[model samples]
Target: MAGVVKTGILGLDAMLNGGIPEKNQIVLAGGPGAGKTLLSFEFLYRNAKQGNNSVMFVVEEEAEKVLENAKGAFSGLKDIDDLVKNGSLSVEGLSAVSNASESMRQSSYEFGNFISDIEAIIADKKATRVVIDSTAVLEILVKDPLMFRKSMLALVVDLRRLGVTSILTAEMSSLEKQSLSFRPEFFLFDGIIMLYLSGEEEKRMQSMEIIKMRGSKHSFVTTPYDISPAGFKVFAAEEITQE
Candidate 1:
């Protein structure tokens, strides 16, 4: 049996019947302002706090901007700077060389130098948890659907082979259209967690649901969640009712 890694988010682990299985590559899917980034950061933060080293690869946003946003969004999360300085948490932005250089950016084959850099970080940091914030940009990188599928599958397989629990964030336009057939990643990952933000103005609410989790039982009901100074607070026991 595979080991489980605690996400450390309040009320979330119980929903997973303990925690996500170790080395499982999961996709965090949601629209804008769905707290995807926050959840990913909190996952790494909590784990690193417990002495588990982690690495975060910022694909869309810069590393410094991510840290600043986290500070503002999760004010209660103190000592983030200290954690980074102490080497408990490492955050890096996608390398420009890997993205721009022809030699590093392969046209038809593989994920080139970008993936190589991530592997290097994992080994150097001895990281057990990894997060790739937003794979939407990656879609742009590959351009071709077939290539994207192949590249992503290879990436997922490589990450799991590294023996680290990984979260790869993806952007979705709507929660109503929940279909795995739309994207190749939905099938490649071992688990899928969907975050949602719906309703109008004042009535708008946030919720999360576990779409699928291989090798472990998980709650299927959509649970409401909040993004406050403390980070993501999931109400797993309370099922969300659309108003």
Candidate 2:
């Protein structure tokens, strides 16, 4: 009861002062290979071990490939695969290529059905933690901004009704400033975690910042982080000491 749900990432919970709040939607934003997907997977995977069921819905990747890639990131992730086999955890991936080929056009009902499917899985798995890897694909799926916003609102509201603490991964632009590729999705969520990749050409480094966290005291500094065989590890960027 004290700990809502822990992400189990090194130094991350330390910075958050605990973990993400339950029954709230938090956006995880980053560019390609910036460790957004890994962070989401790790959070859900860790939840499964803590007796809290978890679910993941990937809109741009294959379900099998997602699990395979996750296995490589965290050796302990073998347990995640086991949960899938044992039906303790549920995972789904709706790739742009596949979903587009099947649906032909993006409609509210199609998006509604996706939300229904996710809801069913949450109930079936008794999931308390949910992750949607990369909502950026929504831009391509729903062409109209208003339509996209409506679809996202419906989805988020339904997820909240299920009493799930959800984390959605979004792909941010490479530019220094924030881009408005999927701005509508941000307004519906309760929190935002921004992953920043800074430095010139060859010396680029990844940093994590809790941009907006509703009803919580969050970190303001951009802390450094890395992905390894274990999972994502956040660290304070060390100053280069010069004599």
Candidate 3:
């Protein structure tokens, strides 16, 4: 039997019936300014603090810049720097060395090599938890939707084989419950977590929902959450009464 990997976020753990199933690939989908990046960092930060060595791989930005920004944004997590220095956590950025468009058109060798680099990093760090900042840019990298799906499927397989529970952030255009746009990722991951924003201006409120979790009995209730300097504070016990 497989044990659960605690996210270390109490409310989130409750929603997952304890924690994400061991080695599950979770898609954390939301729109711009939805706090996706911050939440991803916190996942690593919290888990690392709990002794689950973790690594964060970023594609859209530099690792140093991301870490610096996170430090400023989350003032309450004062020990983030110490965790990194102690080698319990890693935040690194990835660059596409080859022209993804041309390279992927020929074969999937580039993508395979890409996963290899990630595998190497995980091994070097002995990381049990992983986070890929976001995979939305893969469309531009792969170009062909068919190959894109293949690449995502391949990624899913590789991450599972690596024996690490991972989160792949996704960009979404809609936050509404019934109007979410269909995408390949909706089917590729072992679990789907939807982060939402509603209302407008200062009146805006954030919420989360567990759309699906393959093997676990997860809550379908959409719960409210707040992003303080303390990181993500999910209110798993309280459901969003309405939009």
Candidate 4:
């Protein structure tokens, strides 16, 4: 059996038949307000609390904003600031690299440099878990779909080589129409977790499903979940009914 890295989200581990396979790259797919960021944050925060070092690469939002939002969203996870300050957790923004490479000048060079920097940080910190908030930013940088797929595959391979379990977030236009036919990342990733927001406006609800998980048996049911002050709470036994 492959080694596992506990997600720390309540009830999620049991659904995964234990936890995510060590060194596997999983994609957290969802639309806006689906709790992708919160879930990923909780994964890292929980791991850090267990004496594991983690690094979060913020691409869609500013690092400071991500940290601030995490504090409010996960009030039950104490000492978040201290954990970051003490180097047990690290949150970094990709804005600098994005801005510097904006002219499309030497795109490959800039991208390679950024990857090198990430690898260096992982090594320096001995981080066991990593999160890349929104791989959508890479779509803007890479332009060509085929090239983006190649780049993404390379990045995942690198993360695996570094021996760190990683979560890469991706935005979907609509959860109802999601299909793996055209998404190369879906094929490359070791697992895919899709988050959903059902109902209308005021009555909206959030849920998640394990679409695919390699090397392990996982619950395929759409499980109801909530983003509370403590972080992600997955109701593994309760299914989200379409009313």
Candidate 5:
């Protein structure tokens, strides 16, 4: 069987037909407070629980803080503090880089360094699953779409080459008419998952739509999902539409 990586979200594997394809790059696009971080954390945290080495490459959230937040999200998460302290779960891009953009200029280095740091982590940890918390950081760092696309392509290529199945989270605009500037990422990655929060009449609902999954079969409908203390749980819309 081809090596496969599970996302750790309940019912997500079924939607993707069998988890994220081996050696592929997938994007988790959503707006702030849309459970992107929570979902990605569940993904990596579950892998660690399964004895599969994992790494979380966070550009937007601090490494230490991310883990701290994850504890509340996954009640069974073990030794995250020790794992981070012992270098099992490594943190990268602590400091911002130069001329990258307003968002990244504060970091000690540029996005390139962040990518390299992730590569090193995979080699060191033998990580099978990875999550780049927010690729949107690059959108702010590189103003030109062409340059942004090239840099993103390089990072995605490098991650896949390492045999790492990665989840890249991105922030989207709340408006249906106002789209994200980094829409180009859909082309740069292997799969695209879009999360949206909207109200139909009087009820507010959360929906997860799988836009594309190259080389694999995936559900075509917008599934309902919820973020809770246990992490993200995806359910068939028909079954949960009442909420």
Candidate 6:
């Protein structure tokens, strides 16, 4: 409890052996429709409810749309607006391609502006938790693979140095991790969780697996989870055998 950063997501926290280690950057990898955004927001929402300041940085989509979607989807979370208004939870969009200068936009390595904006927001909010919607948008902004990895590593380092536990979502194509290849940047983070859809179309289900956690022993079994109006409920005590 003293050093761990609790996600407050019921079974998720139990899987982490309490919660994520302080200042560890955890990547949430999943395919489309895997409830990645909702899960990430829940992490922030739950923690914020417990009084830890949290912030979410949107890479491509509008921030308000994310807020509204969360409100509509989680009918039980009636206080999301109140959290935002009270400054406990903040969702801000960051776009390097749109507002950056022509030179920075044209250069693959000039991503300092994005970092600066993020740092400013975190500092302003005194946030202890952070989430970056999806890292794919950052990749598109930097076409060079090598530079993208470099910039990502730099971003991870900055976040760690800032002393905040954060989540970075990655986009994947639908089943079996067959889509959305990730770069070596993942090695820069402390933990990895793969959330994907399984089963035939008619019988599909959402599941989560913990790939690695640096300082804690975590569950390796692919566990089943489903989204509900109350939020996400993870069946960590049971394992779902893959076909």
lDDT of each prediction vs. the true structure? 0.82, 0.75, 0.83, 0.82, 0.73, 0.83
Please tell me which model should have the higher TM-score, number 5 or number 6: 6
Candidate 1 per-residue lDDT, tens place, 17-69, comes to 78999889999998878889889999999999999999888878778899899
- Angstrom error at residue 109, model 2: 6.2
**Model 1 residue 42 lDDT score:** 93
In terms of TM-score, how similar is model 2 to the real structure?
0.85
Q: On residues 1-243, what C-alpha lDDT tens digit does candidate 4 reach at each position?
A: 569999988989977878999888999998888888889988998899888999898877778899999999888878999899888888877654444344334465445555776787788888999999888877887888888878887888889899899999999877552442336678899999988887887888778888888988788878888888877788887343322
User: How many residue pairs in model 6 have overlapping backbones?
Assistant: 0
Model 5: residues with Cα > 4 Å off, grouped in runs: 76-110, 175-182, 200-202, 237-243
Q: Give the TM-score of candidate 6.
A: 0.89
Please give the RMSD of candidate 6 to the true structure.
Answer: 3.5
Q: What TM-score, computed on C-alpha atoms, does each candidate reach?
A: 0.90, 0.85, 0.90, 0.90, 0.82, 0.89
Off by over 4 Å in 4: 95-109, 177-182, 238-243
Clashes of 4: 0
For residue 157, model 1's alpha carbon misses the true position, in angstroms, by 1.1
Task: Tell me the tens digit of each residue's lDDT in model 5 across 181-242.
Answer: 44766788889988887766448677788888887777877888877767788995433332
**What is the Cα-based TM-score of model 4?**
0.90
Off by over 4 Å in 2: 1-3, 76-78, 95-101, 104-109, 175-182, 200-202, 236-243
lDDT by residue for model 6 (1-243), tens: 338888888688777777888889999999888988999999999999999999998876878888898888899888899999999998886443235434444664357777877888899899999999888877877778898889898899999989999999998765574554554888998999889787788799888888888888777777788887788888877343322
